[model samples]
Target: MSTMAPACGAQQPGNIPTPFDWWPFVAAPIIGGALVYVWTNGIPIINGIVGASGAALGFSTLTGGAAGAASIATLVLYYVLKADGCIRSVPKGANICFSGIVNDTTDENSTAVDILAPFAMGPAGVFDVVVKSTYWHYVTDDSFWVYCDDAGAAMLPCLVKSETACGGHIGSLVGVTVGAIGGVILGYLAAAAVGIAIGCTATGFFYLLCLIIAFIIAAIVAAVVAYAGAVIGGAAGEGIAAAANANDPVVKAWKGLSPGDIVTVQGNWVTDDSLGNNEIFYTTSINRTGNVGSPGPYTTAQADDAIPSDDCNSNSNPPPPR
Candidate 1:
């Protein structure tokens, strides 16, 4: 019996074509969520996307929906907690600007690649206490930390600050030259006195002539030694200065920073999960607004004054939410 020739691609008795795959629908959202995770942690987007895509493809129809739902739930929970003041989640690329007194600084590392300085917003003890204890901390959270980076160094006051580190060490060169000349003169005199006897001169006129010659020779020697020393010292000084300037602008700026200086930091705000969702300013610019020795641990009013009117807290003042 001819079995109806399988009706041209119709489903066979036992083999029903699997329903159109629903996994792709589920995987798309999951992949997107993973990308967000990668981006927040500073992973390259293309790499994160490719890796996430690969991971998503492995999901089967049964597991795909569950994974996608979990991703959605995780994202929703993050935001909800963020709004409820239970979690801190600052989106990447939020414009951030604030001013404060520098409190402590962490040296650059391979991961950060920039100097991180934590500054004080309000009075150190009071503000720090409030931030640690309060639920609504984000409003005041930004005032404490800054990243001194190469990009920020190219900006206004930072360039001005680093410029001071670029000049040659003229004082060191001069000191070395003077020291060399004095040493040569002392050594020449000591050797000449040891070899020459006072009685060797037959007449006073002869002795005077010899003395004149010795003085001339010593002067010439000192001049030669001083010139050679000057050249060497000058070169060393310039080399040192050049090496100092060769470092990235951020390093130069970091050298210039001090605890008492009032600084205004500007950059994109990112919440560092690695630092426990602590917000950081990935600096584009750092300005030494003023140099007031130990201006903070300020009162709330004084801290408000430290911030520029155009910045993050322009509308609100800090000290636990209203």
Candidate 2:
């Protein structure tokens, strides 16, 4: 009888993607259009239909006003729905377990190492597991949330539970708000410049020339807005990191840390365990009572003491080993 080995790919437990990344991609274009419209006609409601149309038609013959509007809308929708997230460390020779929403997969081959079962954890969210061999061969790659599934068979199903909406909202909102404002401002500036040039040129034969220049300027502006929208969307999507980090108990504890305080952390860094690389550790020591040379036992009273250096140095003081 042949024994079946565990699935090759699986997502590790405790790692999940945040939801906020989807918002900025969705909102930035809408906001940008509104801003442009308001800047042109002083009304917010018609800004999307009017400003985007004007910018689009002004720039390219192939994409008329309507096409331009559709393009912008589509672009906005694409960004809002796009998936991006940090990567997970997978140990070699171990099966990766996947839970939550699994979408697609891609292969990443590098000279440093060959990564198999790079899967996309679709929009819904994802959790992953990685297998590592004892050799500790390569550094684990940062993981990402993807939009497709079945791309890598390495992902396997795990137990299901209630899904919590974490980190996604804040990240998306910040990106969308900033991107939209930037897009609108840039769009209006481009429109204004075009309008100015048209008004300034008085040559009778220059009417066509003025129109062409205006169109060119508007196109440039629209492109700028679109680029800004994407950037904002990307930032918003990435904001999940901040959200997750903010909620971490370790980070929370570190928040109150001062210069002269001694902090002992159970430091363990993610590394390629298969390659035999040593785990990275973090430690700090402080002399709250006095200068660097003079150390204290880090009593509660010394919390307010002003230590000269922010991070503890080797010669400063040593924290208790874990």
Candidate 3:
């Protein structure tokens, strides 16, 4: 048997493959992915996706309680700052520290920062820049700096009676946006995993992708929440060392507060009770406690603080007598 070439005129009935158009191939995944994202963002299906994702990730780490706590924590911090500007503001009672020269030292490994300034006639008082943010493990020397009326002042620590100030607000706001974008990517992956397991179609897959994107938005929102938790937690964590400024009028006026630090000086017990009237008994405390955040105003013994009954407790402020 022999194969013969067909004549040009009789190229004959042979079928030819059509040229492949790049548009459909290129656009399908994109369009499909986009549609999947958008469509999955709507009602019913979106909830199902999250519920499934939560289930897959395990409810232990990502629980409704955690999210709710994050939200409530953010709102509480908002109000705490709102309720009393003092909680957010530095001690204005004494601003001009005679300490013309601000001397600073840092712990290179841990980056613990200390500032020494003359407080009135008292010796140069060395204070932590972040009395409240002590628990924060990443504080660098650059976390905060001193601002003097005259940076060129003489070497002696003048009457340093200045209050601490919050330094990371502006930087934190910028970081939140970057965190949001990164969160979106994480959410996409989380949602996609759940979406695909449910037998998502190509188009449906992209729509689901959008849902996870929303989750990233949500996570960023949660981070926004954590920001407050951080603030509250930070403020609630540590307090002025009882030994630090026992005689500094500036420190006493501020009631031993550091920048971003909020504490109530009530009957010797300091409380970072965002909602409690820790300040009500401020004048009564002969020996005021320092910054307290995590466990907050109410410790385990003080169940009343958690629910805030008629009064505070022995460990903390007891809401005055009815």
Best by TM-score: 2
Stretches of candidate 1 above 4 Å error? 1-91, 109-247, 295-300, 305-322
TM-score of each: 0.28, 0.30, 0.24
Candidate 1 vs candidate 2: the TM-score winner is 2
Candidate 2: RMSD to truth: 17.7
List where candidate 3 sits over 4 angstroms from the true fold: 1-165, 168-174, 197-249, 252-322
Between candidates 1 and 3, the lDDT winner = 1
Of the candidates numbered 1 and 3, which has the greater TM-score value?
A: 1
Q: Which pairs of residues clash in candidate 1, taking residues 3 or more apart in a chain or in different chains?
A: 123-297, 123-298, 124-297
Model 2 — TM-score against the truth?
Answer: 0.30
> What do the candidate models score in CA lDDT, each in turn?
0.35, 0.32, 0.29
The CA-based lDDT of model 3 is what? 0.29
Candidate 1, residue 137: Cα displacement in angstroms equals 6.8
RMSD of each: 32.2, 17.7, 30.0
The sequence of per-residue lDDT tens digits that candidate 1 reaches over residues 210-321 is 6545444443444444444444444454456557657655444555676545565654444433222224333445565555454333332333354445333524534332
Score candidate 1 by lDDT: 0.35
Better of 2 and 3 by TM-score: 2
lDDT of 2 by residue, 213-253 (tens): 65555545555555444444444444444454545443333
Native-to-model Cα distance after best TM-score fit, residue 86 in candidate 2, in Å: 13
